[model samples]
Target: MISDHILLTLQVLPILPTLAATNLRQRISAFIHERTYQAPPDGHVKNVIVIGGSFGGYQAVKRLTKTLPTGYRVVLVEKNSHLNYVFAFPRFIVVKGHEQNAFIPYSGISKGALEGIFHHIQDTAMEVTERFVELKSGARLEYEYLVIATGSSSKLPSKVSSTESKYAQQELRGMQDKIRQAGRIAIVGGGAVGVQLVSDIKDFYPEKEVTLIHSRAQLLHSFGPRLRDLITETLTGMGVTLRLNARPDLSSETNTLKFWNGDEEMYDLIIPCTGQQPNSNIISTVSPASISKETSHILVKPTLQVMDDRYPYIFAFGDVAATGGPRMGRAAMFQADIVVDNIQQLIAGSRNLCVYKPKFWFEGAIKLTLGKNRVALYIQQENGQEILVDSNLGHEDGDVKSQWAFFGADAEELETRKI
Candidate 1:
C-alpha cells in the first residue's frame, strides 16, 4: 500500500512543474510587457466587465484576457482584494498559524503580456444597469458586455466576511480562538462546510464535545448513498455526535439549542453553516425577470446568458446562478468557460454561441477532510456509479501554499500584494 504521505504527494506532484513553468514565463513576460505594451485610446476600447473574483469570475476574466481581440479588455470588479482560498477556510479556522494563507493575491491573474489586457477594481458593485455598473465608490464603469458571477455569501469561516486580507486573517483567528475555548460545540448544517468543520474541530480538539446537526436525513443530501454511508461511519467513528433529521429552533437563545422534538442541548458555542444566500442583488433591480423567484439565483439559459432576452449580453454563473446543479467551484469554472466563449462569439458579430450543459455528476466532484490528515474524495464514473476514496492524505493547513502558488501568488508577500 502506498503511504498516506506518498498518496498526497502523488496528487500534487503532476501540477508542480506546470505551475513553476507558468509562473516563470509570466514573470519574464510581465517585466518586458510592462515597459513596452501601450494601451489603446479610451474611445477605441470596449470593456467586458466581469463582476466578482471568485472561481467563476476569475476563470472568465483569465480566459477573456487571453482570447479578447484588440480594442477589447476585461475589467474585473471584485470587492475582495485577494482571491480567497475558500476550501481551506474549514481547516484554517480550526488549525492556527495558517489563516493568513487563505487569501491569495489577484496580481497574478493578469500574468505575462496579458497584464495590459486586464484591469482589477477592488470595490463593491452596488448596482448594474443595461450598460454600466455603479460602484459603491461612486464610480461608474461602462461595459459592452457584463458577466455577473457574484457567487454566494454566508457567515464567517463558511465564507470570509472581509474584503481585505488582514481583516480576513483576523476573522479566521477569532473563530479558531472561539473553537478553542468552547467545550460543547454545535455545528448546524450537514453540508460540506458543516461536515468538514465538525470533523476538523473534533480532530484538533478531541476533548471538546462536538455535534453536527442536520435537518435532513442524509449529511450530503445531493450526493449518492455510498458516499453518504461512508461519511456517516467516519464521523461516528470520530466520536462526532450526528443528529440527523434534527432541526434547531431559531428562537433558542445563545449557547443553548432547542429542537421541535422537545430536545435541548447546551453548547458553549454554536456555528451555523446553513443558509448560503446568493449575492445577486446588484442586478435584481435592473433585471427583475432575470432572477429566479424560487432560489433568488440569477436565471441563466443553457447558453449561460441571462434568461431575459433583453439582456443577452449579461451572463451569470457560480453559486449565484441557477445552473440546476450543486453550487461548487468546479461547476463554476466549467460555466465560466461557456460564458467566455459565448461572449467572444457575440463580440465577433456571430450568432453562433456555445451552450453550457450542467455536467453535475462530473463537476460535482468533492474532496472532504474527515480529520487531521484524513480525507475522502468523491467522484462519479461514466455510468453514474459513485466512487469514494477514503484516505489519510489531508494536510493540517490543507496545503494552502500549493493553492497560493496555483494562483501564481507569492507566499512571502501576500498581505501587501496589490489587487
Candidate 2:
C-alpha cells in the first residue's frame, strides 16, 4: 500500500521539470523587463494599488514594478510603516534586547530601478469599492487594478498587534520581563506558537515551571504524527509539563486558571496563544458576496483574482484569501508571483494568465526552534517518510540579518533603524 506522502511525492515529482521551467521563464521575463522597460509620462499613469505590505503584498509590488509595462505604477497602501517580521515574534517576546529587529523599515523598498514605478502610502484602508479605496484619513485612491493582501491578525506573541515599531518593541519587552519575573508560566494553546514559545521559555530559564495547555492530544495536528511525537518528547525532556485535551476557563482570575476537568492552578503569568482572524473587512464592506461564509476569508479564483466576476480587476491572496492551504508566508509569496504574472498579462491585453496551485508539502515545511540554540527542520521524504533534521545551530536574534539582506537592506540600516 502506498502511503499518502509517497503518493503526494509521486504526483509532484512528475511536474517538477515543468514547474522549474515556468519559474525560470518568469525570472527571465522579469529580468528582461527590468532592464529595458520604460515608463510613460508621469501624467498618464495607471495605478495598481496593493494593500498590506507584508509578505504577499510586498512581493507583488516588487514583481509588478519590475515586469509591468509603461504607463503603470504600483501604489502600496499599507497601514504600518514597516514590515512586521511575524516569524520572529515568538522568539522576540521571549528573548531580550532584539525586539526592534522584528520590524523592518520600508523606506528602502523602492531603491534602484523600482524608484519611479513605486509609491507607498502609510495609511489604513477604511473601505473598498469596485473602482477605488477610501482611506482612514478621507483620501481616496482610484485604481485600475487592486491586490488585497491584508493577511490576518492575531494577539501578541503569535503576532505583532501594533502598527508602530516602538509600541511593538515595548510589548515584546514587556512579555520578556513577565517571563523573566514569573516563576510559573501558563501558556494556553499548544499549537506552533505555544509550543515554540513554551520551549524557548523553558530552554532559557530551566528553573521556571512552564506548562503548556492544549485542547488537543497532539501538537501541530496538521503535520504528521512523527513530528508531533518528536515535539512532545522534546518538550517533556526540557522539563516542560504538557496538559492536553482541556481548555482553561477564561472567567477565572488573572493569576488563577481552572481547567475543564475541575483542575485549578495558580500562575504568575498566563498567555493565550490562539485566535486569528482574517483582515477582510474592507472587501466585505463593499462586496459581501466575495467573503467566505464559513472562514470569512476572501473568495479568490485559481488565478488569484477575486471570485466575483464583477471585479476581475481585484485580486486577493495571502492569509486573507481562501487558498485551501496552510496559512504560511511561503504560500503567500508563491501566490503573489502568480498574481503578478496574471496582472501583467491583463495589463498587456492578454487573456492567458497563470493560476496559483498550492504547493502543500513544500510550503508546509517548518524550521521550528526547540531551544535558543537548537532547532528542527521538518521535511517529508519522497517515500512517505516524515523526517526531522535536528540541528544545534540556531540564532538568538531570530536570524534577522538574513531577512535584512533578503529585503536588500544593509545590516547597518537595521542596527540604526533607518531603513
Candidate 3:
C-alpha cells in the first residue's frame, strides 16, 4: 500500500529509537562510572582470582563478587560446565526421570550481575602459585589474591564414576540394571552414603536381599553409641542385613567379601562406601609445607588463610583445608563467610584478621532416611556429643518436601550468585 521509500523509512524508524535508547543508557552508565570509580594516580585496581566452582567454590565466588567494592576483577575457574545439586542426589535416583532437575546451568549467573567483573574458565587448574594459576590447557592467569575452594573427590568402587552427573543417579541406574541380574547386593562401609544406599535399595526393591558390611562394630561410630544404636535398630527393622566388624577380601571374578571374624560371603553386586580423599594436590604443589601428610589437608589459620607466613595472599577453605574441625558442607559454607570477610578486609587495605570459631549448634544436623518412612536426625552437642532425634514420614509426606526445599534453596542461592 505504500511506496518503496516510505516502507523502508517506516521499517528503519523502529530501529532508530532502540539505538538512541542504547546510546543514552551507555552514556548514563559511563557518566556514573566516571563520577564514582575514578582512580587516583597511585591507586591501582586489584584482581581477585577464585579457583574451583563446586559447592564451597561457588559460595566463595558469589560472596566475593557481591560484597567486594568496584574496581576489582574476579575470575572463576572450574572444570564442569554446570553446577550440580548433589544433596538431592539420593532422591533423584529413586524416581524415573529427575536427573535434569539436579543440575543447573552455570550460565544462569551472568557477569553483569557480578559487578561487571567476572571471568569463567572451563578448565582444570593444574597448578597455583603465589601470583598465577596454570590451567590444564596450558594457559596461565595472574591475580592479586587467590581463594582455593576445591572440595574432595569421592571414593571409587563404592562411588560411581564422575562421568555420571549425580552419584545417586549412577547408583540408581546401576542398581536398576544390576539388580535384575544380581541375586544379592553387598555394600561395604557403614558411612552415611553406604547406609543411605542400602535404605534406598530396600525401600524401592523389597524382594532384593541387601547386606551392609562395615569394619567397625557399630554404625556411625562418630555419632556416639546412642545414635549408633538407633541407626542399627532402624536398618535392622528395614530388613537390611548388618555385618559388623567385617571386611571384604575383594576378588575379581567371584567378588567374595571376607570378614575378620572368619566369615565369607559372595555378592552379585559389591559396593564400597568407605571414605573420600581431598583434592589438595593443587595446594600441595604450591606450598607443601602448609599441608599435613597425616591428615592430607592444609592447616589453615583462624582467618581461613593457609598457615604459611610466606604467602599471606593465599587462602583455602572447604574440605581441602583443615580448620581443626570436622569437614562438612555446613562447616565449609560457614568458613566461606570468614574467607570472604578476610578477603574484603585485605582488599580494603586493612590488616585486621578475623578468627573463625566453630559453633556446636550450627555444626550441622544429619538426617538419615530409614527404609520404613522414618528418618533419624543427629544433633551434636557443645561437648562433642550426638543426640538421636527421629521423624516418621513417607516419600509423599511433607518431610520430603522440606528436604527438597532445603537442598533446592541452597542450590538456587549458589546458582544465582554464580559468575
lDDT string for model 2 (1-419, tens) is 77544555665688799879977997898788777767667678889999999988888988887787777889999998689888888898888878888888775568655546888999999889878999998999999999999988888787766778888788899888999999999999888888899999999999999999988888887788878998999999999999999889866657999887888899999999976899998987678999999889999899988889998899999999997756888889989988888898898889998988776667777789888988887766445567566778998987898987787655787777633
**Candidate 3, residues 1-419: lDDT per residue as tens digits?**
55434543554477578658855764565455444542222235566888877667776776665555677756788876656555545544444444445555555444333445566777889888878899999998888889888777774333334533445345555545665566688878898777877877777777889999888897888776767888787778878999887777754456787666677777888877777777788877779999878978878898988999888889888888888656667777777767877887888899997888876444555767765466666666567645555667545221333433433344454334333
lDDT of each: 0.84, 0.85, 0.68
Off by over 4 Å in 1: 1-38, 251-253, 411-419
Candidate 3 TM-score to native = 0.79
In model 3, state the lDDT of residue 109: 40
lDDT tens readout by residue for model 1, 1-419: 66544544555577579658965764574466456545666677889999999888888887776667767888999999889889999998998877877888887686653545888899999999999999999999999999999998898667887899899989999998999999999999999999999989998899999999999999998888977898898889989999999998866567789998988888899999998888888898889988888889998898888899999899998899988766888899888888887987898799899888776655787899988998888876446666667888778778776877777777667544422
For model 1, where is the 10-residue window of minimal lDDT? 3-12
Whose TM-score is higher: candidate 1's or candidate 2's?
2
Prediction 1 TM-score vs. true: 0.89
Per-residue lDDT for 119 in model 2? 88
RMSD (CA, Å), candidate 3 to true, equals 14.9
In model 2, pairs of residues that clash are none
TM-score of each: 0.89, 0.92, 0.79
Better of 2 and 3 by TM-score: 2
